[model samples]
Structures are given as structure tokens and as C-alpha cells.
Target: MANTAFMKPRAVSDALSAIVGKGPMPRTQVTKKLWDYIKKNKMQNPKNKRNIIPDEKLAKVLGSKKEISMFEMTKKVSNHLS
Candidate 1:
């Protein structure tokens, strides 16, 4: 089997509520779901491809930042995980 250590899954319970709905999901899944939310909502900042605009719910998780870059996004979002 593929080594799962480097690819730990995110628990849905950990991320669902903060991410979209509810979770007990893996990190990869959470990231996927997050991207899904982003894409579905057109959250990517058009002017700057690396930046993202958080919606109301996302803003809460993002600490009220109107915009964030892809790099900063992960750091900001980690706060909502626990």
C-alpha cells in the first residue's frame, strides 16, 4: 500500500463545521472540500491569481481577512481546524 504517513487524511468532524457543513474527514479531503467551496463560490481573486476572497463563512475562518494568498490561506485556515 502507498505510505499514508505523508498523506494523512483529515477528519470530517474536525473540518466540516468550519469548512462547509460537518466533518470527520481527512486533511486531503478537507482541502478538496475547501477548494470545492472556493471554486463553487468563485472565491479566487481575479486580479491576483494567488489570492483568494473569503466569503462570509470563510471570512470567519480566515480571521476577517477580505483577501488572502494561497500561501497564507493554509496558515489562516489551520486555526479553524482545532
Candidate 2:
């Protein structure tokens, strides 16, 4: 079986906690919550589905980047976890 290390819960940073709530949560749940927030806020770029236009809350987590690719989004989010 594949290792489950990546599934272990980790502390969410303040910036991310603002969006996903404060807690130690698994990476999958974090990603799911992020996507849910994105969809709820209609932050996805219409022209490019893979790109995300972060809203004010996400901006803080993204270090104020106006937009980022989905892949890059994951990388940035990883920094917020311990």
C-alpha cells in the first residue's frame, strides 16, 4: 500500500485558517476545503480553468499574488502547514 504520511494532519497557518478554519487537518481535507472556498467565492478564472484568481482572504495566503495556477496554488498552500 502507498504510504500515508502525506495524509497525516498538520497545523494550519493563520492565513490559511482564515479560509479553511483553524485546526490540524489532513492535507486532503485542506485541499478540499480550499477548493470549496474557491468555488463558493467564484475565484476560478473563466478563461483558464487551471488558473485561480485568489480573493482577498486567499490573497493573504498567496502573499498577494493576483493569480496563480492550480499547481502553484498547492505549493503555496503547503508552506502554511507545519
Candidate 3:
């Protein structure tokens, strides 16, 4: 069975909403959308595939961090969801 908490829809913060849009969506969906935006904008670091270089919009969601790992991405994004 899937974890209920992970699947539960949560409200997205304004910064994140700008990237994924405003809505109550599951955490998995939110992550998927976030990746979609990252790929669409070619934000992944060429030297290191695990690292993501946030664009102007993503920078807002990721705070002031210049670059972040894929694992860290999920952790940081969780902060923007309630």
C-alpha cells in the first residue's frame, strides 16, 4: 500500500505555485511537475546530472541556494508545502 501522508494533497506555497501552479496536489505530483519545469528549462547541470541549477522562478522556491542535488531538491520543496 502507498503511504497516505505522501499521497495526501497539500497546499503549495506562492513561490512553488509559480512553478507548479496554485493547487492542492500530492507530493509525488508536485515533484513530477517540478522536474518537468526543470527539464523544460534545461536547468540540470551538465557537469553533474545530480545537481540542478535553479532558474529565476526556481530560485524563489529553493531560496538563495545556487545549486542543489536531486535528493536535496525534494527536502527543500517539502518546506514549501503544507
What local distance difference test score does each model get? 0.70, 0.92, 0.91
- Candidates sorted on TM-score, descending: 3, 2, 1
Full-model lDDT, candidate 1: 0.70
Q: For residues 1-82, what per-residue lDDT tens digits would candidate 1 score against the true structure? A: 8658525644433333666567544566667778998998899988887889988878777777578888888877666554
Clashing pairs in 2: none
- What does candidate 2's lDDT look like per residue over 1-82, in tens digits? 7558778999999999999998699898899999999999889999998999998899999887688999999999999999
Candidate 2 lDDT at 17 equals 99
lDDT score, residue 24, model 1? 47
Question: How much lDDT does candidate 2 score?
Answer: 0.92
- Candidate 3 lDDT over residue span 1-82, tens digit each: 9999989999999999999988699998899999999999999999998999998888888886599998988888989999
TM-score, cand. 2? 0.93
Model 2 is weakest, by summed lDDT over 10 consecutive residues, at 1-10
Q: Select the stronger candidate by lDDT from 1 and 3.
A: 3
Stretches > 4 Å off in candidate 2: none
**Number of the candidate with higher TM-score, 1 or 3:** 3
TM-score for each of the candidates: 0.75, 0.93, 0.94
The C-alpha local distance difference test score for the whole of candidate 3 amounts to 0.91
